[model samples]
Target: MKTTSSLSRILILVSALLMVSAYFTPLWQISLWAPQYPEGLNMKIWIDRLSGDVDIINGVNHYIGMKHIGQEMFPELQYLVYVFGAIIAFGVLAAILAKRWALYTYLLLLLILGLGVLVDMYLWGYDYGHNLDPSAAIKVPGMAYQPPLIGYKELLNFLAYSGPDTGGWILGASVLLAGLASFREFRAK
Candidate 1:
């Protein structure tokens, strides 16, 4: 009987633990700056909710015709916790099994899930920015307020910066650990 290396199993288990952090930390953040507010404003996105100056941000978004953001507005928030739980479960199972194939499959699924998250966020941003209400207080014929998917962008006078936050960093580290484990496994074969 062939057995997987101890290091691979340990790494997979560690990855599972790191994924749990996603539940409590904000996964992404957007910061806004304009001449009026030199201190800047921030919005945090989590799996199941939004935080950090959301009311202020929503007030600002109203002028640009973006829909008011609330937890009820995002259906994904209701289901994403389960998805993260499943990923964590899978990682734990792979670690316990200590099988080479199991580890590889788990890593691949995790990677695909991560990419899906990015795409979903982009789609949400696109809709929020492009789908403006016709009767908004302020109207600029062709202006859109789409926040950057993963970087900085200028949305009129506001400079917006979007990137991964605490949970995101943990997710990234989990992915990195899985990758390193895969690399080691492949080399051993």
Candidate 2:
């Protein structure tokens, strides 16, 4: 029979690969698919495409300051970082806690994470423009999108603390994998 440690090692490798794959996706872009809730796409890539426009930065600033414009899409860049942090944390913590209790906890975390994101996205998907007459443009329908927490010091504080300690869990998982593998060698007995 395959040993517990051997299986754990393999699982750890698989988890790492899955996270890396998610990292390269255009989670930053909004599309017909992920533009709104339940199942939605990222919107940041869509903004990146317009980064070359001479007016984009000025436009983004206006929106962050609460100006009513489709340009509200910019500050949402914060979510890209948020989701990345979530994925890394869940992947490492759940992967390391691959034991019975840890397994359930990990699954619960996944379900909660997915639902949280879906709900958040759904609210964001509301589009007043879609239903309005041609001449009347409208703001989106959901929670008024707000400027992300701002200022240099505040931003740095979030990146360091609010971003989640995934790095710690990632290292912990790696060390556990190596230690477990070494302690319970996978060679044929």
Best by lDDT: 1
For model 1, the superposed segments whose C-alpha errors exceed 4 Å read none
Model 2 lDDT tens row, 118-167? 45544443332122233323333442332221111111111101111233
lDDT of 1: 0.91
lDDT of each: 0.91, 0.38
| Per-residue lDDT over 22-111 for candidate 1, one digit per residue giving the tens place of the 0 to 100 score | 999999999999998789999888989988988998999898799998888779889999999998999999999998888898899889
What TM-score would candidate 1 get against the native?
0.95
Candidate of highest TM-score = 1
What lDDT, from 0 to 1, does candidate 2 have? 0.38
Question: Could you tell me which 10 consecutive residues in candidate 2 have the lowest summed lDDT?
Answer: 155-164
RMSD of each: 1.3, 13.9
Stretches of model 2 off by over 4 angstroms after superposition: 1-9, 28-76, 79-83, 127-189
